[model samples]
Target: MNANLQRVIVLSLLILLMAATRSHVFSHFTPVPDASWAVFFIGGFYLRNWSRWAFPLLMVLAVAIDYAVITNQGMSFWSHYCVSPGYWFLVPAHLAMWVGGFWLRRNYSGASVASLARLAFSFVAATALCHLLAQGGFYWLSNSVAEPTFAGWAKNYGDWFAPYLQGTAMFVTLAALAQVVGEQISRHAHPFARRMKH
Candidate 1:
């Protein structure tokens, strides 16, 4: 397949998988692992400028899926989300993540060790920023919770930090590794392709 078509298909699948992760798909799993954060990073990394509209569009899809889950799970449409007006802040929260990957996309130098380091740093930094913005925003701004104090919020942030970090790390690392492997395969395949042609 053509590169553009391949990108489209890959991006589409990533978005769908991430979006569905929030729904009833794996609700039974503890903490319910989701790829929401990873999707943003992957989009920025892979889609680059092509992600201009896709980011916002994916955000909407995520919200819609959230609503679907809440309604189906028999909770108030908006209230069940544990969100308040502040939930809208997810836009900028995820934007930071997307920009991180976009930055990496510009700077990444293939499968070199430096490239891996860059991806690792960018992934961790993006996930941290995204988490702080999201969790911190919710703590201070969400009406669903009773007036959370700084200490309380800090404690909450600490409590949730490990899991979020683990999840983001897991997905981003796997993705980066996969990309490296793919690059290696392609690099090696070219010679084989030429030989086959001969």
Candidate 2:
């Protein structure tokens, strides 16, 4: 099989796995564990050649799956997801995550200290952005037409911060686990890395 195709298939499977694990295996109160970040960062670390397309594809698939499941539950997720003004900003927040992973690939070969620092920094920034975007989305959905007063925005944003922080912290822990697992998987996938041992 072509290497890029393999990466895509692997990524697709991992995304599906993450979705299943998120929706079914995990409890509702628990934030979804992000094992897919392993696939994502590995795409950057091992399949750097495929990162451009693969990362976006995986992210979109994850989002679509989540939306589908939420809609199936007959909640107001349609407006909660689509009509919210924060979605305008949320898309870029998500895109930035993939971009950060791709940027990590450009700078790191998975072996250098400074490069590792860059990757770590990217992860931190992306995690923080995800938290803020999620909170913003919730705020917009809850207060769609309210006047954008300082106090109003403040209260909205502040009200969101607690849950947002809790979820983001959980996600950060998952991201760390995924990153470590991804690096290991990348090492195993590389023919050169395998050959070097012999």
Candidate 3:
């Protein structure tokens, strides 16, 4: 299979997994295990420039899933939970994750301890930034909060940070493992294929 096609398939699966979390299909489950945080980062890591377009496409899917879930469940689309102005902030937040992945991909070294350390730092920073943008955006800008305040926002951020971070890290770890395995397989296959060709 073509590498690009393989990448597209993998990224599409990631996006679909993330979007499913927001859809009626999986709405009953808690958001703590959502794959969205890793989706953007992994998309950027693999898709590179393709992610610039893919990120927004996934965002649209998320909104569409929410809309479907809302209407299916007999709720007003306009007034669905967290479907407020602050929700738009997710664009930049996810983009931040994407950008972090792009940067990591660019600086990616082979799997040395130092390289793994860099990947870890990048993952944490990106997830934290995404959480802050999303959490802070909702607290400050959403109509859901009648009287938003810094103190209140700070508390909310503290409360939500752990689960969100955990979900992101979980997905990222899985992705990293897949990436390593794929590279190793390709690395081993190259030498074997060459011998056969000769």
**Lowest summed lDDT window (length 10), candidate 3:** 22-31
Residues 21-93 of candidate 1: C-alpha lDDT, one tens digit per residue = 7674326355657888888888889888688688888888878887777778778876754567777778888
Per-residue alpha-carbon lDDT of candidate 2 for residues 1-198, written as tens digits (9 for 90 to 100)? 576677667566667666765453113355454444344444454456766676667667766765776677786655653446665454555555556666776776555568657867876666556546655664655455465665775676676555544543454445546657877887788987678888
Candidate 3 Cα deviation (angstroms), residue 77: 2.0
TM-score, every prediction: 0.90, 0.60, 0.90
| Per-residue lDDT over 1-198 for candidate 3, one digit per residue giving the tens place of the 0 to 100 score | 787898789777886677666453334357457777788899888888676577778778777876787788888888876777888888889888988888899999666678688889988898889989988888888787999888988889998888778877888888898878978998899999999999
Model 1: pairs clashing at backbone N, Cα or C within 3 Å: none
Tell me how far the alpha carbon of residue 78 in candidate 3 is from the true structure, in angstroms, after superposition.
1.4
> Which lDDT values do the candidates have, in the order given?
0.81, 0.58, 0.80
TM-score-best of 1 and 2: 1
Better of 1 and 2 by lDDT: 1
- Which stretches of candidate 2 lie above 4 Å from their native place? 21-28, 31-48, 80-83, 141-198
Q: Ten-residue segment with the worst summed lDDT in candidate 1?
A: 23-32
